[model samples]
Target: MAKRRLGGGLICGLLLAGSVLAAPPTAVIIGTPPQPDWTQLTPAQKSALAPLSKDWDSMESVRKKKWLGIAERYPKMKADEQNRMQERMREWARLTPEQRAKVRDSYKDFNQLPAEQKQTVKEKWKAYLSLPAAERQRLREAGKSVQLLTPPQPEPQVDESLAPAIVGESPASPGAVPQ
Candidate 1:
């Protein structure tokens, strides 16, 4: 019995020593790059991502990496492409987190469509854009009414710049409502 107790104590002591000598748990995630704070970005990265400066530090590591990749490519893009990217970034930065999540979900859904279905969707979008502004507004209002049975939520404040980019009609234009 004494020998058994000594053996048990020795095993316990080894385990305790092993645990004590082990490295402390790290806050760092494996397989993902370190998310750099905004101040850590280089001048060119800052310039390329100026629109997102306010939200950069709050962004997820994956998102930061994606944007950093875009910034790296920004200098090589054509002038027109660069301008469009900047405009889109500004619009994206203006979106609330829920809106951004919705956009991401929609994008994923769209990408999962078969090639033919994707083409059909693109065509349908074009057709919708071709409709008269008043008709579009009427359609939008009708769609809203269809959702009346659902619980009401506060409306997201629409940015005027986002209006034209989404519906091909400037907010200043007659019958142009930001959806």
Candidate 2:
């Protein structure tokens, strides 16, 4: 069979959907650096990209482009987290083409949700997760929107300005002399 194709948008959407289903972390954690290129990857790493490898020859362009984005934002993750990610990658490789297609479709549906409805669903889910199943079902019957919790952003800090010249050293100062 001819190799299957996956669009960049679909791939990104799938990753986003996967992130949404991920369990909330009690503490924030850094993620691992992705293998920058196939050549940089180990045999096990190649295994992680398996079923997709038949298409890999044609897919390298997409892989390189996506991996570069990952590399730039990548942080050094704790070892245990790295191991878990590797396992996930292995399982991701095992997904059948049809399963992948279904995931992509689900992602498309999620993306189509209205912003307000999405927020309501998100709140509802959080509230539901905290309640008994009967209470959650009641809330579910009420029906609300849902959206994924956004990944955390780093806090901003003020930019440090260069030290200004001392009063006597600079031409801009009132008392400084010109040559």
Best model per TM-score: 1
Task: For candidate 1, write residues 1-179 as lDDT tens digits.
Answer: 99999999999999999999999998965756778999999999999999999999999898999999999999999999999999999999999999999889878977877777677667667777787999778877889422322223447888876866666676577567655
* Model 1 misplaced regions, further than 4 Å: 1-31, 130-179
TM-score to true structure, per model: 0.59, 0.34
Question: Tens-digit lDDT track for model 2 on 72-96?
Answer: 3334656676566556656656777
For model 2 the local lDDT of residue 25 reads: 77
> What's the lDDT for residue 123 in model 2?
75
Q: List the residue pairs that clash in candidate 1.
A: none
lDDT of 1: 0.84
Q: Indicate the TM-score of model 2.
A: 0.34
**lDDT value, residue 154 of candidate 2:** 40
